[model samples]
Target: MAGKAPYIVPVGPIHPALKEPVHIELTVVGEEVISADFTPGQTHRGIEWMGLSRNPVQIVHLTDRICGICGVTHSLAFARAVEQIADITVPERGDYVRTIIAEFERIQSHLLWAGVAAHELGFDTLFYLAWRVREEAMDAIEVITGNRVNYDIIQIGGTRRDITEDQYDKIRKCLNTYKDLFSKLKKLFLEDAVIKSRCVGTGLLSFETAMAYSAVGPTSRASGVTADLRVDYPYCAYGDLDIKPIMPTIYGSDVNGDTYDRIVVRIFEVAQSVEIIETCLDNMPPGPVIWEEKVAKILSTCKKASGEAVGRHEAPRGEAVHYVAMDGAEAPISWKVKASSYSNLHVWPIILKGAQLADIPVIVASVDPCLSCTDRVAVTDNGSTKIFTKEQLAKMSYEKSRRMMQ
Candidate 1:
């Protein structure tokens, strides 16, 4: 142990106690992590590559599989790319509907991540309460699109169906219900001393580092990096809506650019998304959801020219960019998807190095990383590897609480 290479520890693939299948390799000198190598390619399924050969009609569902939690973002990116390629314009009402659905996705996603973060940090009661409230959003998705996880309602030109007055009424009620609960939940998570002590100064990321590393979403915004697609670069009906892009420390302090800051950014955004959805609903206009006759005509119009298009959408995690190349056929020649998780996840080793092992889950959860998009693992350690069961970790946290009480 005198003059040896640092111990390299691999954190996942099928092994994270609180995350999906992404792998993290950390090089540690004694108890301090000196560097980290992130490998998120284990679960790569070439979904985007497959989109190249499938007809434009089939690519919609393929996009949905990229990230189950933010499937709508993927679909929207692909659909927008295709529309750009074919020069098909969506109706104003169609744009508003798309914005509503996307905002709904953001609200539920942030809530899910917040609950998971609470659970990871040993705050089980808060986790349960937050998730129970998030169910209202899930129900809304089900009522609107007949599915909760993967809506599959975004077609090539427009949505598969229009939002009914009944759906709008239900959503309004859900928002009101969420608003009250969110106020309570926000206070507990953002201002709780215990939560703040663990998260406030941990996982610090500077604004420059965030920009250099291409961080996005709450991860970037928490660090005071001005990068939000909805506000910085408007898309869809986002331009029509009033979005100030909530940053961290808005509750009463300046940004600490830490895990706590990231959590606060997300918590506040849940309310922001709710407000945007309400605006979209209030401004709703009547029109056909799908552009039926024009799609064929548009396809015919594109047959004479070969072109390509790119579409970018802000997902719950960050920016989702899609590249589509069309050869004037019914399908795209090639399609490439760069999920927000791809860039945001790379900042992990930088954030987790100095933190305690017990805090790893909370730090990882803070970014709301989407591991299904990038997954892989490798390990290097000289000592015996220790694996703890989920029950063991739960017991450890519980025992620690008991000791504190004693």
Candidate 2:
């Protein structure tokens, strides 16, 4: 900790977590943050509120725009909810197809996070390498869905597109490319001295803390909390696959959910996603992708659908859950979206306690937060919030690094 500076300093009203604007108020004692509180909801799109006004068919498209990284998963979750309400049964092929696309999204998202994590610690080389490899996944996804980010593949009862043999081959090639780099990625991310120093003991979140805060996905997995919706809730084709959550303990980490552990867990998850995608492709049964009869009369069916259901998808970040209630009308009577970022926000204060100003970005990014999906606003009239410029933040990190070197 350095000498006590300002009494109350705001670390962010903007961050590199694009479309994920957040404001964090940090109370500092010198350079070490003594306490912190954050403001979310800066990216509020009111998708949930708007969803209630639309029919299930229309809401499907709305959910897809919730977050680009996990857009498919959000729509999948919405579809699951609607399907449950309508007592709709997706074909085996549909289930497998959904799983494949979700896993591919996971692989791509984890690579994105890996690159961002490397960049946070001033390792631009690794950052470039990770993203350079991510291009392959994007290519494969485009080949399958005709779009890179928002595939819009998962419809209510089934997927709108089928995985042709040629696309499957391309996917395999992409996975193979990732597999070939596994050893190199494994070494670079896990064993690199600089990565270890910056991340190993930083942003520590214990398993107990994770559970207490209801953390999910890699955030909790990094802390050895085996909590994953794909396993726990067993939705879609995850029940058929032998799903295993990745924990950082495998790398001799103390299960002390630090930024480093988060990195390891996300990287391991990319490998796991590849395996799951391969399994899904191999075992997919031959059938039409979407329920043609249902789509032909979708509006009529949803207008008559009356029930409540919960949908859960293991998004790239964590669990993207939606609760839906239909009142036998063209629109849902009520709908609520709880993205992973909502659950993840609670754990931040715990992890950020006693953390240095230089570590703020690392700790915040560790959770893979998606404020766009889950955020709330706290408004105050004529609020006086202190701001730090990039130059100031960078100088703080550089000074800390210099001191560490000294």
**TM-score for each prediction?**
0.88, 0.90
**Which ranges of candidate 2 are over 4 A from the true structure?**
1-6, 15-19, 377-406
| Candidate 1 weakest lDDT stretch, 10 residues | 371-380
The TM-score that candidate 2 achieves is 0.90
Q: lDDT values of the candidates?
A: 0.81, 0.84
> In candidate 2, what are the lDDT values of residues 171-221, reduced to their tens digit?
899989999999999999999998888887889898888888999889988
* Candidate that would win on lDDT: 2
What shift in Å separates residue 190 of candidate 1 from its native position after superposition? 1.1
Which regions of candidate 1 fall more than 4 Å away from where they truly are? Answer: 1-6, 293-305, 375-406
For model 1, residues 226-266, the per-residue Cα lDDT tens digits are: 78899888988988877786787577778778999998888
